[model samples]
Target: MLIVHVAVTVLLGIGAFFLLVGSIGLLRFPDFYTRLHATGKCDTLGGGLIILGAMIYHLFQYPETLLVSAKLAFLIFFVFIANPTATHAIMKAAYKTGVKPWRLGEERR
Candidate 1:
């Protein structure tokens, strides 16, 4: 269906856009913490939306593969939970290890 295709396209596009934003932030941000923050938020949502698009597409295009969609849903959930948790853990580790945040006029690490 045209509508279904459009919806899938939109989700995929938004997901890709977020992914791009995350990558740019990773490259452009001044410091490690900020980069981590960028990727953590954008990547989780981007990856989740991409997977959601896949799940939706499969649900409509292959009705018998409900199991596939269910599995993808689990994957989406895992990414949503795991990425942020992992990011926080890493940030905590960085803080504990005395990895300093960037201040103004400092050279990039």
Candidate 2:
């Protein structure tokens, strides 16, 4: 359906936009923790949106592919859970290893 196609297109575009912003943040942020925060948040959202778009498109375009949609849903769930957890773990490790947080008036790391 035309509506479905339009929705899919919009979702894909927005997802791509978030991904681009995340990558830019990764490159531009001064500190490692800030960069990780940007990427961890944005990547989870962007990837979920993209996968959701794909799932919706597949559902409407090919009703037979229900299993695929289910898998995509699982993938989205995994990303949502894994990304933040991994980010926290890495941040904790950095702190334990004496990686200091960026302070105001300090030179970029």
Candidate 3:
């Protein structure tokens, strides 16, 4: 349906936008922790949105591919669960390694 197409397009576009913003933040942020936060949160949301859009489009376009749809659903669920957990793990490791948090007006040690 035309409405479904439009909605899918919009969702994909927004997802792409969030991914772009997250990438920019990763590069531009001054500190490791800030960059991690930006990329972790934004990438999770962005990836989820993209996966959601694809799942919707596939559901409408290929009603017979129930298995494929289920796989996509699994991917969505996995990314949602895994991305943040990985990010948190990385942050924890960084903390354990003595990577200091950035403070305002203080030089990075």
Count of backbone clashes, every candidate in sequence: 0, 0, 0
Residue 3 displacement (Å), model 2: 0.7
- Candidate 3 residue lDDT tens string, 35-108: 99889989998999998999999999999988888998899899889999999999999999998899998774
Model 1 residue 42 CA deviation (Å) reads: 0.4
C-alpha RMSD between model 2 and the true structure? 0.8
Residue 38 CA displacement from its true place in model 1, Å: 0.8
- Alpha-carbon TM-score of each model against the true structure: 0.96, 0.96, 0.94
The best candidate by lDDT is 1
> For residue 54, what is the lDDT in candidate 2?
95
- The stretch of ten residues in a row with the least summed lDDT in candidate 2 is 100-109
TM-score of 1: 0.96
What C-alpha lDDT values do all the predictions have? 0.96, 0.93, 0.92
Q: Candidate 3: where is the Cα deviation over 4 Å? A: none
Clash pairs, candidate 2, are none
Deviating ranges (above 4 Å) for candidate 1: none
Query: What lDDT score is found at residue 91 in candidate 1?
Result: 97
